[model samples]
Structure formats: C-alpha cells, structure tokens
Target: MSKLENIRIEGIFIKEEGRKATLKFDMPFYADSQPVKWADSGYNSISLEIDIFDIHYLEIKT
Candidate 1:
C-alpha cells in the first residue's frame, strides 16, 4: 500500500470549543513521481492519521 500524505493543522480549536474540528487536506502524492506532478497520475485513495482527540473527514477527487 502507498503511504498517505500528511497535513498539518495549526491548532485544534479556533474560537470553537469541542474535541473535533473540520480540516482541509491535499491529495496524497509523491514528489519524486514526475507523472503525478505533470501528467497527474496519482492514486485517489489515501490513509490518514489524526490526533488522539481529533476527527477527520477527507473528500477525494475522482
């Protein structure tokens, strides 16, 4: 399986009080792949890791 891309969030809560928050993540990719950058040939699915108290939702493009 391919490694999932990582997204860094600035803070857990931004004026909101809760254990969860919404996030925006870029599609997983490898920089070494030229086709993925130029031809755009990357996989659509990716594994994600989140903080212990945080939740995540990902929307991938087909």
Candidate 2:
C-alpha cells in the first residue's frame, strides 16, 4: 500500500443510496516528512479519488 501525506482535498461527493463518499485530490505524493511544493518539477500531475463504502460513522471536526 502507498502512503500519501498532506493530501490537499479539492472536492467531495456523496451517494446517499449506497452510503458512499468520494474524496478528490490533485497531484498527491508520498513523502516521509514535509509537504511537497506544487511548483516542484519532480512532481507528477495526477488526480486521485478515494471512495468509502458502508461508512458506519463519520465525524467532522473543524
């Protein structure tokens, strides 16, 4: 499994029928420490979507 750090969330979508949720991110990178710079030439331009199904519970703390 790949570990992604400091994920910047771009969008969120939810499906009420299936109790599913999707998280969208742009150019996510795996780093041991520190956040990656967006302007870095080494970074790849990629889009990521994570889906969660049958979520039993969720809490949002801001």
Candidate 3:
C-alpha cells in the first residue's frame, strides 16, 4: 500500500506537455514551509507546471 498526502493548488489552466500540465496562478506560493515568489511582475499572471503523473484524478465543471 502507498501513503497518500493531500495537496491543494489554485490556478488557471494553461497548457500541457507530454506528461505535464502548466497552470497560471498567483505567487507568494508555499509548500511544506518552502516558499516561492516573483521579483518582477512583467506578465499579468504567473505560471505553474505540474506533472500529470502526480494527479490521481480530477473533476471538471463547465
């Protein structure tokens, strides 16, 4: 059996690679006490890239 950890991410759907999907979101992001921030804000939004393999399942509402 595998241990499952919960992860929550809020972002906008961007695009996908071969095995990854990119998301657009806000910064001041943190995980496991680690933090990330952008020094500059040239673009209107931030992008987050996540692996599809990390996702067990998802629900889409449209």
The top-ranked prediction according to TM-score is 2
- Give the local distance difference test score of model 1: 0.43
> Could you estimate the TM-score for every candidate?
0.23, 0.55, 0.23
lDDT of each: 0.43, 0.71, 0.43
* Residue-wise C-alpha lDDT for candidate 2, range 1-62, written one tens digit per residue: 97767667798887887488988987555444534574465654567898999988776543
Worst lDDT 10-window in candidate 2: 30-39
For candidate 3, write residues 1-62 as lDDT tens digits: 95323323465452343334555334443344333343243333434544454454556543
The per-residue C-alpha lDDT of model 1 at residue 10 equals: 32
lDDT of 1 by residue, 1-62 (tens): 96644643333332234455544444455345444554564555433334434434433353
Lowest-scoring 10 consecutive residues by lDDT in candidate 1? 8-17
Candidate 3's clash total is 0
Which one is best on lDDT? 2
Please give the TM-score that candidate 2 achieves against the real structure. Answer: 0.55
Q: Candidate 3: where is the Cα deviation over 4 Å?
A: 1-20, 29-47, 60-62
